[model samples]
Every structure is written in C-alpha cells, then in structure tokens.
Target chain A: MGKYLPKAIVHSDEIDRLLAVEPGWTKKKSGVEKRHYAKSETASDMGAEAVKKALQNADTTLDEIDAIICTSGTMEQPIPCTASLIHKKLAPARPIPAFDINSTCLSFVTGFDLISHAVANGTYKKVVIVASEIASVGLNREQKESYVLFGDAAAACVVETADEETTGILAAKMETYSEGAHLTEIRGGGTKYHPNFHHNEQDFLFDMDGQKVFRMSSKVINPFVDELLQEADLSIKDLKAVVPHQASGMAMRLLQKKLGIPSSQFINVIENYGNTIAASIPLALCDAIESGKIQRGDHVMLLGTSAGLSLGGMIFVY
Target chain B: MGKYLPKAIVHSDEIDRLLAVEPGWTKKKSGVEKRHYAKSETASDMGAEAVKKALQNADTTLDEIDAIICTSGTMEQPIPCTASLIHKKLAPARPIPAFDINSTCLSFVTGFDLISHAVANGTYKKVVIVASEIASVGLNREQKESYVLFGDAAAACVVETADEETTGILAAKMETYSEGAHLTEIRGGGTKYHPNFHHNEQDFLFDMDGQKVFRMSSKVINPFVDELLQEADLSIKDLKAVVPHQASGMAMRLLQKKLGIPSSQFINVIENYGNTIAASIPLALCDAIESGKIQRGDHVMLLGTSAGLSLGGMIFVY
Candidate 1:
C-alpha cells in the first residue's frame, strides 16, 4: 500500500480563522491540524501517482496488473470510469479491464472484498485497487465542521493470493442502512438534482449530519464487529492490529473502545490526513506496515463506516 | 429481468419540433421514434421500482437477495451508492450489502460479470442487479444528435447460479482502450470540473463524438466478439440470440454485419426505448425473453461498447 498527498497543505487552523471559528477548533473537534489539497490535479491524476508508488512499493510493474479497480468516492469524470484514466497513465499498452466500485468511504474495503472473490474464482491474478479522493474540491467551507475533517489524498494496493492458507481475507461483511442515507450527501451532480435544473450552489457541495452518522455508527459498529469476529471464529485479542477508516480522531477512538482493541492495536492517521474517504483504510494499512504495527503472519482487520450509512469489516492475515 | 419505464411517453417528433430538428430526422438517423421519460421519478426511484419488478419476475423475496448491485450510468445521489437507496425502498429491514459498479453504459454487464464471479466463489447466494438511467435530465438540447438518441429507463435482474451446469455465464470478456476516453463525456459534476467551480450548463450535459465512437467500436467489436467466442469454444451459431446495447439502430446493424450474425438473432429496441445507458443490455434482454426471441436453455450473448472506449461480451445460457 502507498499514499500520495497533494503538495498544497492547508492547515485546519487557517480554515478556522477564515470561518471565524475559535482557535484550535479543528484540532480539538477532529484532531486534524493540516491536510493536503490538490491544486491543478484531478482525482485520476492523484490516483495515477499513488498507483505508480504502489507498484514500486510492491516491486511490480504495470504489465503484471490483470485489472484496475478505482474505488474512489470522487471521480475525475462522469463518463469514463476513473480507473480507465488511471490505467492510461499507468499501463496504456495493456488491455486490462478497469472499472469503479463506489460505496462512498467504504469503497476500498468493498472493492477489496470483490477483488478477493474474483481472485478466488480465478478471474484475476494481480488486481490493483486505487482509491483516490479529492474531497477538498467538494468541501463546503460554510460547513466548517465537516469541511475541516476532509483532506485530499490517494492510496493504491496490488492484491494477490498468498502462498499460505492462513493469509488473505478470512471473513468479511458489508451492510448498508439507507434509512440514514440522507445523513451525508452531495445533492447535486446526480440525477436527483441535475446541474441543468438550476440547483443552489450549496447543493453542489458536501453536506453532512455528522452527529447523526456518528450516533448511528456507534449503535451498529460494535455489534457488527463482534458478529464478524464470531463468524470468523476469532476473538479481538487474536488480531495483531486493526486498520480502520481514518474518518476522524474521535470516531477512531470510539471504534477502538467499542471493538475492545487496545489503542496500540489501532492505526490512526486522522490527525494528519483527516478523512481521506475511500483511501483511509489502505492508507492506514500502509501506515501500520511502515510503523511495524502490522507484520507478516499477523492477523489484521480492516473496518469502516461509510457515507451510505454502510458498515464493513474484513479480517485478513498479513 | 424487468424494466420500469415511466408512463410519460415522448416521441422524437415532439423533441424535433421543440429543438427545431428537421422532421423525421431522429428516426432516419437513429431509429428512435418514441421513448419514455420520467416526468418526476429520479434514478433511485426508478431503480427501486425496477428492483421490485425484478424480484417479482424472478419469483424471489427481498430477504432472498444477498446483495444489491446498482450499475446505473446516472445515479440519484453522490454520497450514498444508488444501491443503498434502492435497497432502502426494496428491503429496509434486511442487512444485505449494497454497492455500485460503474463503467458508464457497460456497467450492467460489468456488474453481472462481478455478480457471477461472486456467486461462483460462494460469497453470495443471490444478487439483484439494478441499472437505472435518467438520461433525459442530462440531455444537451444543443447536442441534438446524441440527445435525441437517449431515454430514461431502469432495468433490474436477479442473478444466481443455475440449478444445472448448462446455465449461468458461459464466457465473459471485458477490455478497455483509454485512448478514446474523451470521445464521450460529461465534463462537469466530477473532480476534473467540480460543480463548485463555475461551469457552463452544457458542461454538465452529455457530449459525444458519435462518429469516433462508431469507428472505434467498428474496429474492435467484431474481433473482440469473435475472440470471445473462440476462447469459449463456441461459434456464433451456438447463440440463439444476441442482446446488445441498443446504442442506435445503425450501430446495431453495423455490428450485426461485422459479426456476421443474422438479423433474427439480433435484438433491438432502440425504436421504442432509445439508448438507456446501462439499462440497455438488461432491458433488451427482458424484451427478448418476453418476445420469445430468447428461451431458457438457449445460449444468449450480452455485448456492448461503453464510454471508456471499452467493449465487453458475455455469453450465457438463458
């Protein structure tokens, strides 16, 4: 796993000052100080960079990739899937099929689960899952609470089968509660509110009821994680580490406590990267590996709650 | 398979008069004389309706669905995957996973391929795939040529392994050529041209180089379909029917001539439905089955070319 962050770093304090928010608001509310924002770079461009770095980290070349799956919450274009653009820059000569899986913030894990099934069914060999988000582009500066919790970044991973049975995804679960679907949304750009229909400027920006999402996730996350562990016939203690979506520092803490995982066993990067949407999990995984929190032959769990009011968990052996 | 077309019917003649198009121009060019448009229904609403009809058509209940895969070229909301919204309307009490697979117009086939792989891998028991497109909302009146070729419709399919080995997907192939990615696109509402940044109304509407797409598809479709049949150890004669993406009547005729398939084997509903984007394939399939062109145990092929400059083919026993 590898991550590519934009060079133009914007501090939350700066935004707070501009919005006339109290000093230290973002840090205290979300544990985010500064985050990167793409300047003259699209999500696909960032994805291409992340994919290149991921290939290098994996010690592999583009031709080795059998397919490309772009799971980003934000896409560069509304026509061609972002994966196609990323592939053009990464492996233009290869005829590998590319598409997109979008489940908002949980897109990466959902994509990983799909890739795992495809690999198990012998449909693919080396699949590259790239999740690049340009959240800053849609951030509502007026909605300071949610805007300050987002950052632009990308992460990619080359996944393949392991030599041992102990490796690979052991158990996975995904569920969406659309009853809370309106909790977080971008009202425009989709069919419901087309730009041609003369929608308000705010309709085009990100809107969120952060408290509702948090409350709903709190009620579901614990039971969902426990059931997933039980179904896999493993206990939380057996996991070497848990790499969760870096949604917010407070959310991560709550998840850590709810899952009964020690603080040391949880990977948290929200303090720096903020909520990178679909890239959060893989980015956290990369952070865990680089910091030696996750090692070979260890059991690690990737979990997250997405904007769809969707919760997903996947346990795997590294 | 099932489709939900809005009650409101709009003929090309009406559009021609509205856009000051030459009388009979649309039918002469694309064979789209009349098509349905959603007067008030949204993509997700149409998708939900389609899913309900699909469930009834498949004689399955909501709880029987293991997952809901939304593969529409247009979505209802930007945050929650359309699958989640459809799932909310279809089975609010169920905890089944919901997500999206997007590859522009080819999303349905791409999603079907993924669902087939998942079912084969035992990750899912039954899946509901819904493709709903509200193309009417994004139609650029200025681009009268492509605009008049599209309609708003939704299609859904319930997929599971067949009771016998003679059924299910027999062979599938998907390939993308990124060089033609810009041939068809909606330049706004995405990261490349965020709605937050000022953009022209036309930028948010669909744009296409029809000639370029036709030339590219002509160069690739025949060879790709032939290779797919060869790899599957089957011939064109083995297929009882070929349900293709009803992009246009002329395009379908060209494909039939190029592939050497008889007109009787080809399924075209463009005259009534126009190009419903991702729903075109499944919608055509349902039309074929209902019209008795495709019968159970018959080998049927679903093939199409998408905006990614991608071509895909899947032969399956009906």
Candidate 2:
C-alpha cells in the first residue's frame, strides 16, 4: 500500500463516554479518547460536519468532490438514510453523486473500496468517503454491557489523483459469516419483527450473546486479516499502523495478539470511542492523520468486523 | 450483460399477515398469491429465510456461497446487520462472505450488480443478494395511505455462472436522488432521536408524503426507465415486462402513461404487496418466473426508488 488522501476531524465530548466504556467488569483498554457522542447527533449532521472538516483540511469545497459514498444510517431507530439526508443538506450548487453504503462497521472500508475502484477505474476524479455513526441511542442504555460501548461520529477522507506517490488504497477484501450473526444482534425491526406504529416494548430491544460474539470475533476476524495481508503482499512487519474496528476490549486484545502487532502499531481509539462500529475505522484514521501517526508514503491496514459477522481488511498506502 | 446467472430465490408464505393490520394484504398483491413474512418479523428472520431459500434454489449449502449482501434491518435497530441475522441463521456451517447492499429499494438491483460483476470477473461463483422489508410494521396501520401501501415480505437471489441459453441477468445502472429522502422516511432512530425504550410512537411510525412521492415517481421514474432502455439500445418495444418498485397505483400508472408501456407490459403487484420496497422487483420476478408471465430469454427491467430519494434501473435479460 502507498499514498493516502489527507483528512481532519472535530468531535464532541458527550459522545466520548460511550466510546470509553470499560468492558463488562473489566478496566478500560487502548489509545482511544472515548467516542464522540452527539446529544442530538444524526448521520446527516455528523456527515455534513465531517465533510466540512475534510474539505477544509483539503482546502477544497463540495463542488470539487466528484462523488461521495457514505456508510451510516442504522435501522435501530429508523430514519431516512444519512446519504439521502446529506444529499438534501448539500448546497444545491454542489450536486454530486452521494449514496449510503450499508455494509456494517465495514461500511467505511467498503466505501473506501468502492471509491478506490471508481477512482482506480478512472470513472471519477475525486471521491469523498464518510463513515458516520450515531449508535449510542438504539442501545439498551441500562445494559452496561452494551450501552457505553458506542459513540457518535462522522469521519471523512478525500481521494484524488496524485502523481507524487502511490500510497492510497492498494488491496481490499470483504466477507460475511452469517453463522455467527446471533452472537450479536439488535433483534427488533426488519422483516422478522417489523416494528409497528404501536411500538411494542417487550419485543423491540437490542439483544446479544456477548461471549458468543467475542468467540466469533476471535475465530474469524484477525485470521481474516492475515489473509488480507497475504493478498496485499505485505506482512505485520510491513504495516506502519493497523486500524481495526472498535467493538470492545475483548475483541481488540484477541485480534492484537493474533496479528502480533505491538500496542503502538495498533491505532487504538476504542478506549475513548468504545465502538462506533462503521465510524470507528475512519474516525481513527482521521485522528491518526491529525496526530502524525500516519504520514505520506506510509503503509497501513484497515480491518472491520461487525453485526453481519462480516469481516473485511484492506491494505492502504499512507 | 453477456453471460447469464439465474439468481436463486427462496420464498414462503408463512405468517405473512400477522405482520399486517390487513392480514390478508399478503395474498392480495398483484400476481403474488403468497410470500415470506415474519409473524413478528425481524430483518434477520426475513433475510435468513431468503438465504435458506436461495441456498435451496441454488442447490448449494451455506459453506459454498462466496458472499451474501442484503438490506432491511432498520428499526433504527442496531447490533448486527440484517445480513448477519441471515448468516447467524445459516448455523453450524462454514461462514460465507456477506454484507448488506443498500442504496435503498434498488438494493435488489445493486446486489445483482455486485454479484454479476464478481461472477463475470471470475472472482466468485456463488453470491446471495437479499432484500427483506417489513415496511408494514414501521408505518401506522390506520394511515390507509401508508398501511394500504405496504406488505411485509422478503426476497433472496442466489446467483451463479451458467451457460444455459438465455436465463440470467443483464445490464444495470444505479442512481440516487437524495432530494426525495424527506418525502419518505422512518424519521426517528440513531443518536438523533434515540428510540425511547418505552416505544416512542414517533420512532415506530413511518412518515411519507404520498403526493410528493407520487410527483417524483411521475416526473422522474419514466425518465430513469427511458434512459436505461436507451442505454440498452432497445425500447418499450423490446421489453416483455417492467417490474417497478411496488409503491402505489398512482405512481405505477403515471409511469405506464409516460413510457407509453401498455398496462400488460407493466407488472402490477403493489396493491397486494403494498410496496415491499426492495423486495418488489425480485418478488415480482419470482412470480413472473413461476407463473410464466415472463418466459426465458425475455427482456425485463428492474427499477427501484425509496426513502433515500434514491433511484436506480436495471435491464435484465432473463
């Protein structure tokens, strides 16, 4: 992997409590500041903000973006997709392609992959990818095990042609494992238990088998990373930083050990951001880029694993 | 556009009505006598069922599938994607690559596009794309405009490479109109309007401006269809059927008038399905295949539009 597009970020502290949740009965872990939770944060608001910041960082404007692929909008509380919402919010003068990418926490990477392909294929010149999450609300807030494990955030990156170097997106792979879905799930909405206008209580809460999920993560995630590394033609020794999903301490530690990446090599933000799910990876990247953890021509890997039991990893050059 | 892959379908009619106020709505859909629905359906249940049907239709087990992409988990719900829910249901089997495809209702077309590309590119042979929607549960049963316009159902397609004469997918293009998002949306969910564990009535109900949506459909849908036809170098003269998003009679009729497509050439099932949204296209296709309304080697177009104010059209030669 080689060069990367520049990015920047801004966040709120209220959302961070959810990001810094300690595991059920365990001390907090990692470099994350605790996630940014919005008091009334919505995907569009966060996406707009992040896009503003990213464009500011790039010293560009919305008119310059060729396209924007956003991965946000949860069904838990149900609303119009963040992409559509953002599209509406966009200045009419800046009418570019924008749509929601719904691939779990891996959505950002998925957006990353799609934008890269679009750019690589020369279909679009400059693409914007945003990973925004407003997850703190759909939770069973009283459930200590899950409530604090999330925050609200939106992170964006602008990808464009560069003659200077070759450190952008190099290789990426996405997979889904339905067999372990029950390990973690928000049991209500959708076709099975379609929410009614009546809003039934007993049947509409998020449920999960924590142990089962931790086990599933242990079983498939990092192992998947190893496969991605092989595909990218790099190894743990080659990567400058590893930006993985922000789910929990249990899943994170197991992944770190399996990959043998040192604490520093791991771009950790979970301690402060708990699990922003789809928003975590890019949020971390935004923070890392700002903190000087990732620089031009550096090789990095972004991995994701979440609700669909989906796992994906990509090799990114800087 | 050249090769063929018949997307396998999984279907059932069990407990379809329990999800509806007019429990009989399931069987009343145009040309659709029965369909799959959860009694208290969750996205996972519908998605899982469709995956099972797809597995059975394709004569392949879970382990054999390379990927599964789907939609419809928004109850503002969180934890896992509807894709994960299906993956979890395919238990004790090896994990399959999976993710959700959501550009809103066009998810079917989007899912099809992804599967087709992977197969054509020789990266994967078996891919499952599912669109499960229990829209009925999200809107008020009393709102005849909303309730009478929705039916809870799911559709899955297991696609694979095939040399069989003319039985498969064709070319597709996806487009989004993020502008119309406000015309149709579930409105509450995510960090913005957290689902009150107490069953926020506002959170559960779907909000749509029927007249505006109709206006968009009337004004834009036909143009979208015409563009696809023109791209294919064909015309209304070339299509045996046009399966549109099952939204409403007014929209469909307006489309038929604008395109000058005879009522016969226009597929009708919205009255019964009540706009299954993403499920409408494939659901219509399933019935067409089984009922012989659309024969082998026939040309058909699948069109989708939903809350994202998103729009997409695909021309399939099946």
Winner by DockQ? 1
The DockQ for candidate 1, computed on C-alphas, is: 0.81
Q: Which candidate is the best by TM-score?
A: 1
C-alpha TM-score for every candidate: 0.98, 0.82
Best by lDDT: 1
CAPRI accuracy category, model 1:
high
* TM-score of predicted chain B, candidate 2: 0.82
Fraction of true inter-chain Cα contacts (below 8 Å) kept per model? 0.80, 0.55
lDDT by residue for model 2 over A63-104, one digit each (tens)? 777766777535322555566676666643343545566766
Residue-wise C-alpha lDDT for candidate 1, range B1-318, written one tens digit per residue: 888998889998898788887999878877898999998887888999988888898999887889999998877877778888888787777778999999999999999998788888778989999999988888888887898899989999999987768787878889988888889888888888877685688899899999999998787777798888987789999889988899988888888888889988888889999999999999999989888889888999899999888898898888
